[model samples]
Target: DDILPDGFTKVKPRKTRRNKTDTTGFPPLPPPKSQSETSHSTASDSNKQPVPNLSVTSTPSTSQVPEDTTAQPPRKVRVTPIVLRDASRWRGVNHKFISLGIKFERAVAVDAGIRIIPKSEDDYRRIIRLFREEEVPHHTFPLPSERNIHAVIRGVHATLSEIEIKEELQQRGYSPLHIIRLKRGGGVPMPLVVVILPKVEKSQQLFNEHELLGLAIRVEVQKNSRLIGQCHRCQKYGHAQSYCTAPPKCLKCASDHMIHLCPQTEQEERKCANCGGGHPANSRTCRFAPKKNLEVIAQRRNVSYADAARDATRAAPSVGSSANTQNVDLATALRSLQQIIGPLISATQALQAIFPANG
Candidate 1:
């Protein structure tokens, strides 16, 4: 029994220590509060503002950032390699290329025709070699319109094999195929494939789609424009696939195997071996293709139809256009004639005044 002292009612005993094993069990769960208590807690939560759910993380505060006193070395820049895709349209264009949407990066190193802009402008430059698909005819001065056919190829199979697709087309009598292409990200095959046909008859002609491959594989003609003249076999620019002499290469990777034979998995990131880029080798985001298109467009805008017609009349006998040269020559001759006749006319008028004509 606990002791009792004066002025105290009673004394209680202190709690005894429990066995360690007693605590082995899980801690007691929170008790279920009374209805009033739960309602009050809910009310408190409702009264407070909800935190915003943002996808982007908040930036660290300035004080949270660590300051480094160590000196840092300069980082080496990796320059993008570039090539001219449409070399045929490069004719008659003089001095430096420019495009609004298209950007030209300075070259870091020169590989073949690809070059980095040197620090010194006065440095003696060797002739820059440009890559081309087919041999451009020297006589093609005005530059012929490109020839190409755009078609949408729908596949019966859920997954299409690019190499086998050709075999199916060959069976359907679509012979001598020039170019076949699908969009990027070939992880799961798409139902529709866009293709280019260089042998098409007309420009911007629409034709009905035809089924081939003994399957529901059908090709519908879209727009027929000038061929971009890219080589599917070599995965190179400037020549047609049919005329390609280089070894077989992948369009997606510029690899040794055919584009259909590439082993690129969906999990792996796409990369271009041609330009060393994140996109595929055949991507228009490539430096070459867009640059060529800009050059073609710029040349077209610079050379008017009337100028082209006049150019066709004269076989480029001089540096300047025939019409301009003729106008300059005529102006010079008129000035010379005026100068030669000025003294004679003045002398004749003076003699008439001296003689007092009809006195």
Candidate 2:
């Protein structure tokens, strides 16, 4: 008991911290339960129903998940194009079609006439019937495509008429659309016929040789002539005016107008739309014209334009070399003639000398 001053007081001793396992500061816990009480509590818990946990979500297993089977989009349908020859009556024809509720894919104005694309074969047949009923001038020839097969039949006698050839082809279980005799440049008929056939599984059979009118005829696939299509409207190659989507271009002056609407006279200076030359767009002498043919051949043969051009260059004979070769041949011919003539002259002189006494 220490005495302190009037303004000061004695300090009490501080208590030490309790150990981590000590629970003296906290409220005393209940005593440990007996084994029987623990067993009873566990049994009660097992009998009680479990309350669903709203806060915690359980994800579904992969095996329990449903698969997605969404359908794919439909494929595009192919359309066939048909040309109408009478362009002047196209407006009336279009109006009539619309009035009749006739459905077509589309129609475009072309130099030949109106080119109408139909959605189905039924529509094509219907249009053809309508044209024939109306006495309209129209050509229904199919364009060169995979579906159209053209073959050349050689050794067909000119005396055999077209009707006879058609009959013969039909008798051979084959369908022939048109059989025309081929002709030379001067309209001289040749012993060859061009046959147009529809594409079928047995279309290749036409390439085999066949006997016709007691004469064996050879058949061959018609080779592509590498002919390019020139669009009269745009004055461009690789496409025709009927299917051309380009704007009109004048052939005479390369103006933005049709040939019939061109204001230039015959005496006016001509301008080409393709090469910008003095000639018209369709001139045969254009340097760029051969490129168009190459493009056509490349597309038909499934080759590149450069490769086609290289092949054409290799196939064409050199003019200078050909002329030199002709000159060499002529000189050789002259030398051979001189050698034969000299020997003959010497023999004739010797014979005359031997027969001098008789003279």
Candidate 3:
């Protein structure tokens, strides 16, 4: 007990109770709710609004969505090229074309002339007609690559006309653009017929034997006779004289003049300009002659000129090695002949001894 001042009060400490441990290993659980309490809690839950699921999403149907038209790429158009000869004479040709409302894809200067590529067939025809109307010298023929594939059919009777052959081919489900009667020198017709067909898989089927008018005829791919162009103006291979801009070169002596104007006579030694060989430049015997034809082989085989040249170089034997190879082959042939002759002579002598001659 203590003496208290006026308006002063004493306070007592509060007591805490200690929790008792369960004899079982598990802790004690809460008591179950009463039936009325549970019913009341269920009623409260039913009254509460349901929460929406933020993770779930729904997509629109394909039929309801608009297509993306801008996503697609545009198709490209194929253009045809046309060549105009003597480009120098066709000055201001582009302006003239513009005035005439002619449309072209592009124009490129080539060795022959101006090569104009038109966007459409209508423009191609219009350009051709314009050239014809102006009396301009232009080549309208398609390039070798642009032309349809050609195949030769042999064993066909010369008496059969082109129309008859074409009709027969049509019956066999082949659409031939043209049929030509192959002729020899001096216009003498041969049994061979050249058929021009479209560049399709079916066209290859023609390279086989077929029955025509009760006779079996064989067909083969028409190979190009000359693979390179020879320029008459310069007496060089690769281009024609009309398109050649090179200076005149004589074929006889390879001089820097026209063949007719060559001062060199036949009595003088012949010289080749291309290979400096003893023969003429245009001679088939020239070492470089095969190189000129490589272009044609490359074009027909659909390979690059460099690849064809490499193949040709590897195939062609060197002059010195060729001579040695010929000598070796000749000696081998002689030895084989001697071996054969010795056996033959022995057989003949034996036969003679067995049967004596009446004389």
My TM-score estimates for the predictions, one after another, are 0.25, 0.38, 0.39
Candidate 3 structure quality by residue, lDDT tens digits, 24-108: 8787897899999999999999999998788756688899799887866768665657667678865677888889888888888
- Give the TM-score comparing model 3 with the true structure, all chains together: 0.39
The candidate that achieves the highest TM-score relative to the unseen native structure: 3
lDDT (Cα, tens digit) per residue for candidate 1, span 1-359: 54557655565778997745546567656779999999999999998999888779879989998898798998854322233333333432113333212223353322223333322222112112212323322111111233355677776454556667667655545543443444433234456666555554532232444555566555577653443656666655655654333457665555787766877643345666467666666665566553554345446669754554445335321222345446767887899999999999999999998897794
Give lDDT: candidate 1, residue 131. Answer: 21
Ten contiguous residues minimizing lDDT sum, candidate 3:
316-325
Compose the digit string of candidate 2's lDDT tens values, residues 235-322: 7665566544455778888889998787775546788888898877776556657566667778988999888767765552221234
Q: Can you list the residue pairs that collide in candidate 3?
A: none
Which of 2 and 3 is ahead in TM-score? 3
Task: List CA RMSD, all candidates.
Answer: 31.9, 18.0, 19.1
How many Å off is the CA of 250 in candidate 2?
Answer: 21
lDDT of 2 at 163: 94
